[model samples]
Target: MPETTGDWAPADFERHGHELLATLRQHFELIRDVPVARPYDAAELMGRLDTALPEQGEEFPRILTDTWENVVPDLVHWNHPAFHAYFSTCASFPGMLAETMTAALNVNSMLWKTSPSASALEQVVLRWIAELAGYPGDSDGLLVGGASLATLYALGAARDAALDYDVREEGMSGPHAKVARIYTSDQAHSSVDKAAITLGIGLRNVVKVPSDDRYGMRPDLLESAIARDVAAGYVPVAVVATVGTTSVAAADPLEPISEICRRLGVWLHVDAAYGGLFAFASRMGGEAEDVSVGDSLVVNPQKTLFVPLDSTALYCRRRGALANTYRLVPEYLTSVHTGGTFDFMDLSPQLGRGFRALKLWWVLRSFGRSGLRSRLDHAMELADRLRELAVGDPDWQCPAPSRYPLVCLRYAPRGGVGSGTDLDDLNARIVKELNDSGEAFVSHSVIRDGYVIRVSLANIHTTADDIERLWAALNHAAEKCR
Candidate 1:
């Protein structure tokens, strides 16, 4: 007879499932339409969790409830429409539902035999996203936890391709002739450097090409950088271009960079962690059709899709290149059934993979392409509105007009009193003051020569009114500081 314990039994699970669903429904309702939490409760919540560990297990439901009561109240609610801190979003309803289902099924999509449907769905979803991203020609994809992992995986593929396919099975111990060099813009996310370092391609191997005035990577500068590296006998293996960079949403000149990469036979990887999805919505239409310029590409639906956290995708134009880089076959893991189905372990580093694709699939199907696109288009509209407001205001300044749904502005006080150092100090104080207030939240980042307040619009429920309230709060904070 099989041993049954705790809530694993069928009847027990059914009862718990219903109760848990009810509790979740209540929680979601409150989270979806309420102020994240009352101000001044951070210390109280932390103190409650400071209690000693129990010697025995408590009832699971009670523990769950305790977590909700104690832990959740302290969480910075991303779901709140007015939450403009950092790069974030209030994930969609379908994504939440899908996450629940993913956990319940709990299939690890490492190999075909482990979970056939899961592996298939992953491939299906990848194709769906690739098409949505406007990349043509034999592109393949696999779900990752987020953009960080996706970039890591993309570089691993680049590394394999650069090293002549010998590194996959023999590991890095073998005699490799090339000192692999990766390149990215100064404005590129720090992940590029981190990925290089983690992959044994040291940070020194990762070249930071200069960006143009708009904070975008200049292709001419990139070509010059590559030439200089080549002249120094450094093998240029990869060019990690940015579609939507971190500090500001600046797109690297992809067409020229892609042409250069093609001419040089270097692997191109575009890290569109925050901005790639907007390729589908570009006003330039045919001119913008050239953003997907690489052997591999990354898109973080989690960032823009209103998909919950921990959802990212990596795609390769040629599937064989990705699989060839990472695939390893020990005798136990070898598969003879190579008829049609794909094993995702060959494509990624994580062998024990969760069913992350389901959340995206659910969101896509639930909302359809038009529905999701509408939300994204709305975010762009909102960003433009914020830009207009900032530019129109004498007390505020929008740094530049680029892509994606963000406005980077610096608060300039009256009388030009705080023109330079004083203005920056005031802006810094303003960010803290608003965060401390806990009514409305806005994040800040320094760009170019001034301190900036970045209003990143990602939440679907955030309306023009919400943006208005956010701006009002910011002005009020500035006034208070003055």
Candidate 2:
């Protein structure tokens, strides 16, 4: 007879767990020998794994074997050393361990009463992140799935704070409420638009301010947009300044923008999802562009903190504002007496929250500030070297500025391409060839109506040699395309 579910003996559980871990270790050991991504037939892959469900128990070891042979080989390995694609993420060893523990000790951190350690530790993690980013020590923050959700929460808070009436009870049609307008640069993340839509602020109200030469949001343009919105009888609620723009990592002039917000009485939310790491290492403009200058900001650990995918910290200068924006207490769930402790459920929209703080705690403890700084510095240094190579090469040039470890370059040879040849087509072909070869992977962004290959180096395993390899491959592909 087949073994009953959840009835495995300790010996069986321990043995299978160890074996599975060994298999994973072996896979990483031979990772360098395998392609970054191997193309597979969709129908064949579906046919292999999409079989009919079985009523009987399946052998765990066999399932793992099948996964190793079939599923593992086909995935686009985002953690690979040569993955210079969209903002690389890593499941560092410490984070992996923490994740395992978190799963085993699955507890809701929505309330301190639910899990005291999880909720309390989350606050400590927030403080640690603020300290790392050189942000205001008094700022209160929380960990969410990612920056997208954090942005939504931030704008929601801004919307509520802007309205004189209680938006939580009366909704968007609150008494004496004017249409809310949010301002962000053309280069800012799409999350702003999404947040606007989700919060009843239509896309039309979210003005896309013009960007300057460096792809940063122009402060003067932002001021003008706010002025125009106010004159048109729309309440200028918030301005989102991107610290690391999606296209080129362009940092908006925060000091001037902050000045505008202060003078105009608008909430300023800094989206530092990609560039917040600079605060831990080398920030620009001294105190001028500090993230703390904004009323609120978000920093993503998944981007540069060597953590796993999807963890963002949203911080607010107004300690009670976030709670005021989202707190809803049900009678049965209400505390008998206020214990002077925070109930995380009062913080944001989530009620069933996971123990995400453990991962950051483990990673912070493992790598420490200096170790993380060293890794981030290395990535930036590699980016600088890559830029040097592009500048030194006669056939290539960086179309956009390289502020962070992300750079935008194009294969534009001076007096080399034949007349009537399209530069975009040529550069796209180069990227296609590189991806098809599976040696490396990169993405492209359109800047100045030209296709620019974007190489982002935020992965922990990425090294100078990996950058050199990608550079050589790029040159070879450019030659082939020509």
Candidate 3:
């Protein structure tokens, strides 16, 4: 075989690494001055990126230069302080350094034997996450790529626990297969529906419970839906209660929903991916007690904790449910220390896992609880400032009540009594104009037949000034559109 190793010499590695580090530092220093997103024509971007298979490898410096020149401009700079679209996150410096070290180590943390330190740190970090969320001390959790996968894993555990049939051994096609139903509020993320589809639960079986005035799930409606499904002879397998909804960040009434799930003997899964970190600040207060009733809960440190992307934890009270559903051991992969030690591969669908725990550990240790809480409180304050501005302005309407750093409002001229289509068109144009202007970025959502703008203040760099500038940009765009 030809020589396969491409390891860089020590001096060369250090030189290139320092150069890359400088690039990152410069990017962050000038991030606020850059546009939140730079729209590129699909064909033009493909022209720049589409290439023939090279028979030889290119120089590292050349590759890095090409990426900086061609790829960086097309990125949607989520780190920008003015990035108000969707949920925002900050890849903190400490987290970035941890990621670099993790890459250099390149450990596959699938099994304890594969990387003992990675496995132990993962366990510790997961416990820290559970404690931070005030979850039961006995709760067990593992990290996944993102909230979507985390939801999938949690639901897999729920599926096995809720059904009498062995889904792993016998499969869903067994004669005992029943229509498994999942219930979530209309405002829940689309990932819930996706998880159902992936788990062999038909999308048609996923029921959308109606939301109350504040966009939170109505407990009475949820109970009625469960009762209706049961009356139809369908098994209510799981109910996903969202603590922080995507559109308005409305938290569902967890206590009542949990009580209903308990009465119905259905699995309760809480999707607190976006709002769970607020637990640190105590902004959630007694509302978080709802998590106590959940069989499984998902929290993403990547969302608001200044960690790098793709660090999500799925905590399950029914730990055996996950292993029973996902664990499979062949003779080749067996180990001597298998009895008490956890092989993360047994709990997740992934067989080869990266050492993602280190970044979270670094971030958590760097910020500590007090530091993180302070940042979260600052975000909440900025959100409140935006809400106050919208509520005070006659031309702007705060349609939904925000429980977190997400604010949903509409720019409604003439007290919003105008034609629905006209208002929708206007707001849509305003969003497009704002994005095109490169001043700030905010997204839109439709609620109760009215289009509203959604602004999230989750970035650590975002401040009151950024929120004020976003308001000014929105008004300017609205004026131009009008």
Candidate 4:
């Protein structure tokens, strides 16, 4: 049969989709092949396509072609092998396919009755992730957007468990007004503070536990802080131990942190957003580190497992605590509930959740455990190589050991580039030069009051050649420094 000319027909859509996919792939190829380009010129883009909204509509093929020409080129390709900036993952094709299918189905997995498969899949996938993270066999967990929400949920559980008030039902009313305090390493992600603020816990109550030389939170400091808080009539509710710190991938002493929490009778939550997956690939028994030391664990498969974004697993040792914190079943919503069913509504804050688990399920089955392990192993190996390269050169300094697939190094000009204002300006210029050149993309962070450049090797496609290109770009950027 001839192709239908109008509306959205299956065959017609598929044909156009294939063409669009090719165009998308072509844009990615350009990013991989020519990693560097001048900034997008506004006037140049204005000449390529329409500026105003269409009154009626245009052909799908024309839209695709125009998008390829005008839109795709402007995007910074996070999937590019050389995109070593920030915490990122180049998601596998299987993950992309799963996302497409789930969006097409558009299942809302609020409860078992709402979408049985999605609810069940999320439960099964969360359990699988928890096992990989080394959570105890008795633990239960749920899928959340990412670490931010995971922390919020864990903190919510802390509030509920410690105060003996069902805040979800009680509506933060009569009881549960105790001054709650949470602790995390000074180097921990800023999400903890944000979560506390949203929870109505004062930001001042989020104590920054000092770190040891390795940058991990100091157990001694933590204990002293807890002791002081308890003495001052404040409830030491929760302590967040970071598995992989955002700045340098530093790991807190989990065993010690857990012990401190236990003695203080406080809840322990491990924020391993960046580094928890290494627990599985690390000599510690792949994914097992996530479960070993906390009442709750937050792991982002999206960051390290090549899964797409918005895939995070929150594993909790105390299932009752999670349900008690978030469960809310109105009479109308409970009508579909039959006893002994797994309803996700009891564990998550969302009433209408997407089928996010399908993507991870597909990726896990497609790659298998061994395949995923190999990818992680390769990333760490490449990171070690980069670390060695940086440290060997007198022009650069690897200030800290990169325990995982992330390294932070700073370029130093020989004979002293400048002093005072000039020194800071030189480092600033170096960072801009490297990013603008795009031979490699490196992120910047402030450590001990000095700016440093960071490179993360989390992509499966990253190669030794890519590492070499990063070094070359660093040298070039250093030369550009005043």
lDDT of 1 by residue, 1-482 (tens): 22445446778678777888788778766653545444666577668788899766566688778877777667778877777767866688789889888999998888898888888787777777777777653577788887888888888888877776477666655665567899999888988888988888889998899998988788898899899988988778789888777788888888889999999888999887787777676442534435466788898888888888888888888668878777777788776667687778888777889988888889989888888778888888888888888888998888866667877888885577643558788889888787777667778778886788887889988888877877787888888886
**Residue 287 of candidate 2: its Cα lDDT?**
35
lDDT of each: 0.80, 0.85, 0.85, 0.80
The best candidate by TM-score is: 2
TM-scores for the candidates? 0.92, 0.95, 0.95, 0.92
In candidate 3, position 265 carries an lDDT of 91
RMSD for all candidates, in order, please.
Answer: 3.0, 1.9, 2.4, 3.0
Output the worst ten-in-a-row residue range by lDDT, candidate 3.
282-291
Off by over 4 Å in 1: 1-4, 8-46, 168-177, 282-289, 418-421
Q: Per-residue lDDT tens digits of candidate 4, residues 365-390?
A: 99888888788888888888888998
Q: Could you tell me the lDDT of residue 102 within candidate 1? A: 92
How many Å off is the CA of 418 in candidate 3? 9.7
Window of ten residues with lowest summed lDDT in model 1:
282-291
Question: Candidate 4, after superposition: displacement of residue 453 in Å?
Answer: 0.5
